[model samples]
Target: MELRVTNLACARGGLTVLEGVSFTLRPGHALVLRGPNGIGKTTALRTLCGLQPALAGEVSVPPESMAYAAHADGLKATLTVTENLAFWAAVYGTDLVEDALQRMNLDALRDRMAANLSAGQKRRLGLARLLVTGRPIWVLDEPTVSLDAASVALFAGVIRAHLAAGGMALIATHIDLGLDEAEILDLGPFKARSPRDGGPASAFDEAFT
Candidate 1:
């Protein structure tokens, strides 16, 4: 699978936040979005996943081929770890719950309720959902939050396995995920200049001129 973005512009709440962002990610590759807070990394990820619309430019990636994991862990509190994986498997028409469990090192906690899991465990379960989706592309936002050093290494291994299998990932994070070959896209250059700053012109304004 190939994801291509060209001169992409993103906005939130009717205000432009990023503009002129472009990148191409092919199968077996990863692209990391790096920048300070409020620079539109999350907005860019949301736009790519079709949760939000781009203000301008183009993004070419099939909706069905993408799996997205946001910062929040979207697990059912009452469901067991295994049950949560099974539920997502049903939704995505996949039967890889056991595979996901093992990949995320959650096999031991499979029978435990999500409510009883720690923050790191919940984050791992959230990540395991991406594997069971069977999609070729993954878009993750702040995926490593709440993870310990060991858990971070485990997550990195999972990402490596995904790439080795010809899957692609687009991640927005501040921490090092240990993915040496992944391309870095610093969103600072693309951050929208505030209209109040009296800069030459906002990227959004320049786009139309």
Candidate 2:
């Protein structure tokens, strides 16, 4: 499967944040979005995942084949780790909870309540949800937020396995994810200029360009 974006424009709260964004991600590949905070990296990912509409241009990717994990882990505090994966598995019509548990190295803690897991463990559980979804495209936002060195290595291994199996991923992160040969999409060039910075000539402008 391929994710193609052409001249995409994104806005938040009626303000344009990114414009003329475009990229193509093919099977077995990954794209890392890099930029400073508030540069619309999240907005672009949201647009790609269909959580929000793009203000302009086109995004072509099958929704059914995509799985998105936001910055928040989104785990139910009262549920066991296994239960959480099972719940998501049922929702996605897949039964890979056992495999996901083992893949994320959460087998020992599988029966523990999500509330009892450390931040890193919870993040791993959140990532494991992607495995159960049976989707080919993974959209992750700051996936390594709380992971230590070993945990980050583990996550990288999982991503590598996915790509080896012809899966694609689009990730937005400030830290290096250690994915070998991953394409980079820096969002800096796409940042929209503020009107006060002489972006476009307007009647209200004291000095029009």
Estimate the Cα RMSD of every predicted model relative to the unseen true structure: 3.6, 2.9
Give me the displacement of residue 56 in model 2, in angstroms: 0.3
Predicted structure 1: clash tally: 0
Model 1 lDDT, residue 122, Cα: 98
Off by over 4 Å in 2: 197-209
Compared with the true structure, model 1 gives a TM-score of 0.92
lDDT by residue (1-209, candidate 1, tens digit) is 59999999888866788989999999999999999888889999999888888888898876788999998999999999999999999999999999999989999999999999999999999999998999999899999999999999999999999999999999998889889769999999998777666534555666776
Question: In order, what lDDT does every prediction score?
Answer: 0.91, 0.89
Q: What overall lDDT, based on C-alpha atoms, would model 1 receive against the true structure?
A: 0.91
Q: Please provide TM-scores, in order, for all candidate models, with all chains considered together.
A: 0.92, 0.93
List candidate 1 stretches off by more than 4 Å: 196-209
Q: Per-residue error at 182 for model 2, in Å? A: 0.3
